[model samples]
Target: MKTYYIKNALRVLLGLFMTVAGIGHLTFQREEFLAQVPRWLPTDPAFMDFVVLSSGIVEITLGLLMIILVKHQAKVGLALAVFYILIFPGNISQYVNEIDAFGLDTDRKRLIRLFFQPVLILWALWSTGGWKYFLSKVKK
Candidate 1:
Protein backbone atom coordinates (compact mmCIF):
# COMPACT_ATOMS: atom_id res chain seq x y z
CA MET A 1 0.00 0.00 0.00
CA LYS A 2 1.05 3.56 -0.68
CA THR A 3 0.67 4.54 2.99
CA TYR A 4 2.89 1.69 4.07
CA TYR A 5 5.61 2.75 1.67
CA ILE A 6 5.41 6.32 2.87
CA LYS A 7 5.73 5.26 6.49
CA ASN A 8 8.75 3.08 5.68
CA ALA A 9 10.39 5.94 3.79
CA LEU A 10 9.89 8.28 6.72
CA ARG A 11 11.32 5.74 9.15
CA VAL A 12 14.40 5.28 6.97
CA LEU A 13 14.86 9.00 6.70
CA LEU A 14 14.58 9.47 10.46
CA GLY A 15 17.08 6.65 10.97
CA LEU A 16 19.57 8.30 8.61
CA PHE A 17 19.10 11.63 10.32
CA MET A 18 19.73 10.13 13.75
CA THR A 19 22.77 8.20 12.50
CA VAL A 20 24.38 11.34 11.11
CA ALA A 21 23.58 13.23 14.32
CA GLY A 22 25.16 10.45 16.39
CA ILE A 23 28.29 10.64 14.29
CA GLY A 24 28.39 14.36 14.84
CA HIS A 25 28.12 13.83 18.56
CA LEU A 26 31.23 11.66 18.40
CA THR A 27 33.25 13.65 15.87
CA PHE A 28 33.21 17.00 14.12
CA GLN A 29 30.37 18.55 16.09
CA ARG A 30 31.38 17.42 19.53
CA GLU A 31 31.60 20.92 20.93
CA GLU A 32 28.17 21.78 19.59
CA PHE A 33 26.73 18.77 21.43
CA LEU A 34 28.64 19.80 24.53
CA ALA A 35 26.82 23.10 24.37
CA GLN A 36 23.52 21.28 24.46
CA VAL A 37 24.34 19.49 27.68
CA PRO A 38 22.39 20.89 30.59
CA ARG A 39 24.28 23.23 32.89
CA TRP A 40 22.70 21.55 35.90
CA LEU A 41 24.66 18.46 35.08
CA PRO A 42 28.20 18.17 36.42
CA THR A 43 30.47 20.82 34.97
CA ASP A 44 33.50 18.54 34.76
CA PRO A 45 34.39 18.72 31.06
CA ALA A 46 35.58 15.12 30.98
CA PHE A 47 32.28 13.91 32.36
CA MET A 48 30.44 15.93 29.74
CA ASP A 49 32.51 14.35 27.05
CA PHE A 50 31.70 10.91 28.39
CA VAL A 51 28.03 11.71 28.39
CA VAL A 52 28.19 12.86 24.81
CA LEU A 53 30.10 9.82 23.73
CA SER A 54 27.74 7.38 25.42
CA SER A 55 24.62 9.13 24.10
CA GLY A 56 26.09 9.11 20.61
CA ILE A 57 26.55 5.38 20.78
CA VAL A 58 22.97 4.94 21.95
CA GLU A 59 21.68 7.11 19.10
CA ILE A 60 23.52 5.09 16.50
CA THR A 61 22.23 1.84 17.90
CA LEU A 62 18.65 3.05 18.05
CA GLY A 63 18.84 4.40 14.53
CA LEU A 64 20.08 1.10 13.17
CA LEU A 65 17.41 -0.82 15.07
CA MET A 66 14.71 1.45 13.70
CA ILE A 67 15.85 0.68 10.18
CA ILE A 68 16.69 -3.02 10.38
CA LEU A 69 14.11 -4.37 12.84
CA VAL A 70 11.03 -4.27 10.69
CA LYS A 71 9.19 -7.06 12.45
CA HIS A 72 9.75 -5.27 15.74
CA GLN A 73 8.89 -1.87 14.41
CA ALA A 74 6.43 -1.07 17.18
CA LYS A 75 8.94 -1.95 19.86
CA VAL A 76 11.63 0.02 18.10
CA GLY A 77 9.27 2.95 17.78
CA LEU A 78 8.50 2.88 21.49
CA ALA A 79 12.18 2.77 22.29
CA LEU A 80 12.93 5.66 19.99
CA ALA A 81 10.08 7.65 21.44
CA VAL A 82 11.43 7.07 24.93
CA PHE A 83 14.88 8.06 23.77
CA TYR A 84 13.50 11.30 22.39
CA ILE A 85 11.82 11.97 25.70
CA LEU A 86 15.01 11.26 27.57
CA ILE A 87 16.95 13.84 25.55
CA PHE A 88 14.28 16.52 25.67
CA PRO A 89 15.67 18.26 28.72
CA GLY A 90 18.88 18.97 26.88
CA ASN A 91 16.89 20.81 24.27
CA ILE A 92 15.02 22.66 26.98
CA SER A 93 18.25 23.64 28.69
CA GLN A 94 19.67 24.85 25.41
CA TYR A 95 16.78 27.22 25.01
CA VAL A 96 16.54 28.33 28.62
CA ASN A 97 20.24 28.98 29.03
CA GLU A 98 20.47 30.84 25.74
CA ILE A 99 23.33 28.63 24.59
CA ASP A 100 23.56 28.70 20.86
CA ALA A 101 24.63 25.65 18.87
CA PHE A 102 24.10 24.22 15.41
CA GLY A 103 23.68 27.78 14.12
CA LEU A 104 20.59 28.40 16.19
CA ASP A 105 21.96 31.80 17.10
CA THR A 106 18.58 33.28 18.00
CA ASP A 107 16.43 32.43 20.99
CA ARG A 108 13.39 32.10 18.73
CA LYS A 109 15.17 29.53 16.62
CA ARG A 110 16.18 27.53 19.66
CA LEU A 111 12.65 27.63 21.02
CA ILE A 112 11.33 26.42 17.71
CA ARG A 113 13.87 23.64 17.70
CA LEU A 114 12.54 22.50 21.05
CA PHE A 115 9.21 21.61 19.49
CA PHE A 116 10.76 19.22 16.96
CA GLN A 117 11.46 16.60 19.64
CA PRO A 118 7.78 15.94 20.20
CA VAL A 119 7.24 15.74 16.47
CA LEU A 120 9.97 13.13 16.30
CA ILE A 121 8.33 11.16 19.11
CA LEU A 122 5.02 11.21 17.32
CA TRP A 123 6.65 10.38 14.04
CA ALA A 124 8.28 7.29 15.48
CA LEU A 125 5.05 6.08 17.01
CA TRP A 126 2.95 6.71 13.93
CA SER A 127 5.34 5.45 11.30
CA THR A 128 5.76 2.10 13.05
CA GLY A 129 2.10 1.66 14.01
CA GLY A 130 3.16 1.82 17.61
CA TRP A 131 0.24 3.98 18.67
CA LYS A 132 -2.27 1.69 17.00
CA TYR A 133 -0.63 -1.33 18.51
CA PHE A 134 -0.73 0.27 21.93
CA LEU A 135 -4.37 1.12 21.58
CA SER A 136 -5.20 -2.43 20.53
CA LYS A 137 -3.38 -3.82 23.52
CA VAL A 138 -5.20 -1.46 25.84
CA LYS A 139 -8.53 -2.65 24.53
CA LYS A 140 -7.76 -6.26 25.32
Candidate 2:
Protein backbone atom coordinates (compact mmCIF):
# COMPACT_ATOMS: atom_id res chain seq x y z
CA MET A 1 0.00 0.00 0.00
CA LYS A 2 2.81 2.41 0.78
CA THR A 3 4.50 1.58 -2.51
CA TYR A 4 1.25 2.12 -4.35
CA TYR A 5 0.89 5.56 -2.78
CA ILE A 6 4.39 6.50 -3.86
CA LYS A 7 3.70 5.30 -7.39
CA ASN A 8 0.43 7.20 -7.54
CA ALA A 9 2.05 10.39 -6.34
CA LEU A 10 4.83 10.11 -8.89
CA ARG A 11 2.38 9.43 -11.71
CA VAL A 12 0.28 12.40 -10.76
CA LEU A 13 3.33 14.65 -10.81
CA LEU A 14 4.47 13.36 -14.18
CA GLY A 15 0.95 13.69 -15.61
CA LEU A 16 0.74 17.30 -14.51
CA PHE A 17 4.09 18.04 -16.09
CA MET A 18 3.02 16.47 -19.38
CA THR A 19 -0.27 18.34 -19.37
CA VAL A 20 1.49 21.65 -18.83
CA ALA A 21 4.04 20.95 -21.54
CA GLY A 22 1.32 20.02 -24.04
CA ILE A 23 -0.61 23.15 -23.26
CA GLY A 24 2.57 25.16 -23.54
CA HIS A 25 3.12 23.94 -27.08
CA LEU A 26 -0.42 24.88 -28.04
CA THR A 27 -0.62 28.24 -26.33
CA PHE A 28 2.85 29.41 -27.29
CA GLN A 29 4.30 29.74 -30.74
CA ARG A 30 7.51 27.89 -30.02
CA GLU A 31 9.28 28.22 -33.30
CA GLU A 32 12.33 26.71 -31.67
CA PHE A 33 10.38 23.56 -30.86
CA LEU A 34 8.86 23.13 -34.34
CA ALA A 35 12.02 24.16 -36.12
CA GLN A 36 13.64 21.01 -34.81
CA VAL A 37 11.38 18.86 -36.97
CA PRO A 38 13.60 17.08 -39.45
CA ARG A 39 13.41 18.47 -42.95
CA TRP A 40 13.31 14.95 -44.40
CA LEU A 41 9.89 14.40 -42.89
CA PRO A 42 7.58 14.29 -45.93
CA THR A 43 4.49 15.86 -44.46
CA ASP A 44 3.39 19.26 -45.70
CA PRO A 45 3.94 22.16 -43.30
CA ALA A 46 0.24 22.43 -42.57
CA PHE A 47 0.00 18.73 -41.88
CA MET A 48 3.02 18.91 -39.62
CA ASP A 49 1.44 21.78 -37.77
CA PHE A 50 -1.63 19.71 -37.14
CA VAL A 51 0.52 16.79 -36.11
CA VAL A 52 2.26 18.87 -33.46
CA LEU A 53 -1.08 20.18 -32.27
CA SER A 54 -2.51 16.70 -32.15
CA SER A 55 0.53 15.26 -30.39
CA GLY A 56 0.10 17.83 -27.66
CA ILE A 57 -3.55 16.99 -27.32
CA VAL A 58 -2.80 13.31 -27.16
CA GLU A 59 -0.14 13.79 -24.47
CA ILE A 60 -2.49 15.93 -22.43
CA THR A 61 -5.33 13.48 -22.81
CA LEU A 62 -3.22 10.47 -21.93
CA GLY A 63 -1.93 12.25 -18.85
CA LEU A 64 -5.46 12.86 -17.70
CA LEU A 65 -6.56 9.33 -18.53
CA MET A 66 -3.70 7.84 -16.56
CA ILE A 67 -4.77 9.84 -13.53
CA ILE A 68 -8.43 8.82 -13.65
CA LEU A 69 -7.96 5.18 -14.57
CA VAL A 70 -6.43 3.90 -11.33
CA LYS A 71 -7.13 0.22 -11.99
CA HIS A 72 -5.18 0.40 -15.26
CA GLN A 73 -2.72 3.04 -14.18
CA ALA A 74 0.29 0.81 -14.50
CA LYS A 75 -0.64 -0.12 -18.07
CA VAL A 76 -1.23 3.51 -18.89
CA GLY A 77 2.07 4.39 -17.28
CA LEU A 78 3.94 1.81 -19.34
CA ALA A 79 2.36 3.18 -22.48
CA LEU A 80 3.42 6.66 -21.50
CA ALA A 81 6.94 5.44 -20.86
CA VAL A 82 7.05 3.97 -24.36
CA PHE A 83 5.76 7.21 -25.74
CA TYR A 84 8.60 9.06 -24.04
CA ILE A 85 11.16 6.66 -25.46
CA LEU A 86 9.69 6.95 -28.93
CA ILE A 87 9.92 10.71 -28.87
CA PHE A 88 13.53 10.72 -27.69
CA PRO A 89 14.97 10.54 -31.19
CA GLY A 90 13.48 13.89 -31.94
CA ASN A 91 15.09 15.30 -28.82
CA ILE A 92 18.42 13.87 -29.86
CA SER A 93 17.99 15.07 -33.41
CA GLN A 94 17.17 18.52 -32.18
CA TYR A 95 20.32 18.71 -30.13
CA VAL A 96 22.42 17.28 -32.92
CA ASN A 97 20.91 19.30 -35.73
CA GLU A 98 21.15 22.62 -33.96
CA ILE A 99 22.09 23.53 -30.44
CA ASP A 100 20.63 26.98 -30.83
CA ALA A 101 17.11 25.65 -30.84
CA PHE A 102 17.59 24.67 -27.24
CA GLY A 103 19.18 28.07 -26.55
CA LEU A 104 22.52 26.53 -25.89
CA ASP A 105 25.69 27.93 -27.41
CA THR A 106 28.12 25.16 -26.55
CA ASP A 107 28.23 21.73 -28.11
CA ARG A 108 29.84 20.44 -24.93
CA LYS A 109 26.77 21.28 -22.83
CA ARG A 110 24.42 19.98 -25.47
CA LEU A 111 26.21 16.68 -25.68
CA ILE A 112 26.14 16.40 -21.93
CA ARG A 113 22.41 16.98 -21.90
CA LEU A 114 21.97 14.30 -24.57
CA PHE A 115 23.39 11.76 -22.15
CA PHE A 116 20.55 12.49 -19.76
CA GLN A 117 17.80 11.45 -22.17
CA PRO A 118 18.02 7.89 -20.96
CA VAL A 119 17.65 9.12 -17.40
CA LEU A 120 14.41 10.82 -18.35
CA ILE A 121 13.33 7.67 -20.16
CA LEU A 122 14.13 5.61 -17.09
CA TRP A 123 12.22 7.99 -14.88
CA ALA A 124 9.20 7.68 -17.15
CA LEU A 125 9.61 3.95 -17.13
CA TRP A 126 9.82 3.85 -13.35
CA SER A 127 6.77 6.07 -13.08
CA THR A 128 4.74 3.82 -15.38
CA GLY A 129 5.74 0.45 -13.87
CA GLY A 130 7.65 -0.39 -17.04
CA TRP A 131 10.63 -1.39 -14.95
CA LYS A 132 8.52 -4.02 -13.19
CA TYR A 133 7.29 -5.45 -16.48
CA PHE A 134 10.78 -5.24 -17.92
CA LEU A 135 12.18 -7.26 -15.04
CA SER A 136 9.44 -9.86 -15.37
CA LYS A 137 10.04 -10.09 -19.10
CA VAL A 138 13.75 -10.48 -18.57
CA LYS A 139 13.22 -13.22 -16.00
CA LYS A 140 11.00 -15.19 -18.39
Q: Pick the candidate with the highest lDDT.
A: 1
lDDT of 1 by residue, 32-70 (tens): 999888889997999999989989998998888889999
Tell me the deviation in Å of residue 65 in model 1.
0.7
Taking all chains together, each candidate's TM-score versus the true structure is 0.95, 0.78
Best by TM-score: 1
* Model 2 TM-score, all chains together: 0.78
Q: What TM-score would you give candidate 1 relative to the actual structure?
A: 0.95
Q: lDDT tens string, model 2, 1-140?
A: 88878877888887887787678657674555575455556558786676667768877886786678777766777778777776666666666766466565567766776777677666667766867876787899
The whole-model lDDT of each prediction reads 0.90, 0.70
lDDT of 2: 0.70
> Residue 137 error for model 1, in Å?
3.9
